[model samples]
Target chain A: MISEDYDRIDATLRSTLRDVLGLSETRAAALDADTPLFGAMPELDSMAVAGLLTEIEERLGILIEDDEIDGEMLESYGALVRFVATKTRR
Target chain B: MLRFGPDQGPLVAVALPLFEDANRVRGFAVAICRALAARGVATVLPDLPGQGESLVPLENCGILDIADGFDCATKEAWNANRRLYGVALRSGALLDKLALLDGRWHFAPQDGPSVLRDLKRIKQASQPHIRLSDADWYFDLQAPADHPDPPVEIAGNLISTALLTDLSVYAPWTPADGGPVRIVRLDSDPAPADRHVPGTALWRRAEPGNDVTLARLLADDIADWIATCER
Candidate 1:
């Protein structure tokens, strides 16, 4: 994917996490490559993860198979964005 | 039933999203109803069978049963000589198909299969050890063939196996199958819609929340659409 497309995916992933997790604008804006997600974020429990994935799929128009989901894909902010970017490329 | 605005004139019946989304977006839906009322349009939010305060248990109700309840609500409005319009959110879009209405407005409407997919994901998330197949996740392999399948609990909602089966093939009512229909979606969603508004998916929020701005904007959209349909 082009840099512009990657940027868009990055932004969408950020907003998806923010909206689904109910994070504030500032907190969402501050998310970076190293920002831990999933287990680190209390709001992102297993149930919330389901909603987050669905919202991401709807917004990005990408289908993420159950097998595609793993700890590494959702390890941190960058990992999640990369996983979505890879899906979009497909 | 929660009634809003004046008793006369065209009425907009509101259908909250199915299951947990209904709880998450109830306040937002109500805000939209109140906003619509402020625009001189009356609206009603009814408790569909198997939902809300309805005495019917969800496990015993089929998809049609809830749709029937919605149809009955609109029939009452039609009997009173009131022009009826439907405003549904998410899976709520599936319920208004059986209602008697001049037009239907859906916001981020989700089809039956999509709803089932979300439920399945939630179930999987809650029980990672259990392997569930898309074909017959609700059925128990050990149970006798004649034994009735038990309800599956997902995200605190006990949904019937029959309903799950129905959802796999259930699609929202389109204009080809019904009266005039309008679809609106959030800007973030890439799905085709008549119009896309700037807002996050409130129904996706983990905690129940309200979006006053989104509600007001949607109310305006609904009011304008209803006016056009009335004409």
Candidate 2:
């Protein structure tokens, strides 16, 4: 289970990727904190990406911007967590 | 042939729209499945013949065939569960209707005068795009004779007669159990009156295109819904 604190974002990310997407932990963890999700994960596509974004938004109570889709934030699980942390901080 | 996955709970079988293979399943269907799965509600998404990887020919596909296929898929795909929900998108009306309350959760959009706007755009576009299915029209609820024209910009400002005729008959499919049959509008905004209706979950955000806001909102909703349905 993920902790309520920001550190739990890792657990949240892992659980979502593994349980919801049925991805193996080895593959899921292979993602670096700064990797582009779409290009990195064969399972991630436009639709899946959209689904992930929505799930994240509703669960985290955050809003995403259209211009934010870049190679930086999506680079890795850590990257996404950092991005979420930045947004939550703001 | 349908795929089976050791159905246990009420089978939640989702029907993909025409020309939309498993790829489109990534968006809404996957969200719904994740939502249900979190609740321990097992879900199934089967690629109809001719579409997706099913290896069927396009010409051989029809609305009835899709619905029947959904039925066969549901029975064999899922183990006998007390409830079965069918979630269909833009063009999956017939299957949605045929699968009516087969004890399954059905997520669809409401058909009203507003849809004409979407159809008109499809008709007028210069490029050849996927034709909006008549299924949207089939679900339209008849507007009253006194019903005013829906705001011009509701869909895309090109409402047509066929589109009008279509919206008049649509009633969001209500199940026998009254358990929430979430009707979400894809690709359009809800009318002002629609905002106040209970059980009408509305989303007006434009496509997020991998943006942070889009991602955040989607993830939050998926997580919340997942949390909600799993329990």
Candidate 3:
């Protein structure tokens, strides 16, 4: 994706995480490329993952297959954004 | 039923989203009702069968039963000589089809298959080792042939297999289906809607939450839409 599109996806991912997890604005804004998610974030338990992925798909206008989800894609903030960016590009 | 605003005017009955989303958005729905009351639009948030304060068990209730409960709520208002309008959030859209209302307003309405998909995902998330097929996820492969199919538990809700089957095909009422319908969606969603508003998806929150600003905005929208319908 282009730089502008990438930035938009990154912002969307941040907001999606905040909304789905009910995080504060400051916490959401603090997320960055290196910020670990999934197991690292206390709010992102297994059940929360389901809502998070569905919300991401709805907001990004993309479909996320069950198998496409794995620890690697959600390992960090940047990884999730890149995964979504790839899906949008497709 | 939780009643708000005036008692003798047109009534706007509200339906919370089904299942877990209903819990997540209950506070938000109440916020909207209170905001609508401030706008002088009466609203009622009812406990549908097998949901909220209702005594009925969810495992024993089907889509039609819940829909009938909603219909009954509107019928009570109709009997009292008041005009009725429906305001539903998320999967709540699927429950208002049988209600007699002058107009229907839906916020981020979810279709049946999509609701089922979310439930399935939640169920799968709770049990990573079990591969749940779409055909018979609630059934046990090793159980006796004559054994009764048991209810499946998803994220703490004990839901019946029959209800899941009904949700596979149930859909919200639309303008094309013979009614005045207004659909409002969050700006992030790309789905077709009569209007798009700036807001996060409150129902997506893992815990129950409220968005007072979005509630006020939607209340204003619903009030304005109801006025136009009355005209």
lDDT of all predictions: 0.88, 0.48, 0.89
How accurate locally is residue A20 in candidate 2, as Cα lDDT from 0 to 100? 38
Instruction: For candidate 2, write residues B1-231 as lDDT tens digits.
Output: 332233464555667544322343335555555555555556677776545566655444444555666776766534443456565654453355655344323233434322333333334232224333443522224566676443222222222343345455544455453554544332222232211222212121223111233323333443344345546
What candidate 3 gets wrong by more than 4 Å, as runs, is none
DockQ agreement of candidate 3 with the native complex: 0.74
CA lDDT of B27 in candidate 1? 91
Clashes of 1: 0
Q: Second chain only: TM-score per model? A: 0.97, 0.51, 0.97
Model 2 residue A69 distance off true place after TM-score fit, in angstroms: 32
**DockQ for each candidate?**
0.84, 0.03, 0.74
Predicted candidate 3 versus true structure: per-residue lDDT over B1-231, tens digit per residue: 899999888999999889988888999999999999999989989999989999889988889999999998887788898889999999999999888889999999999878887888898989888777756777667777797678888888888878898999999998898879999999988789999999868788766778899999999999999999999
The candidates, ranked best first by TM-score, are 1, 3, 2
How much is the lDDT of residue A22 in candidate 1? 80
Best by TM-score: 1
Clashes of 3: 0
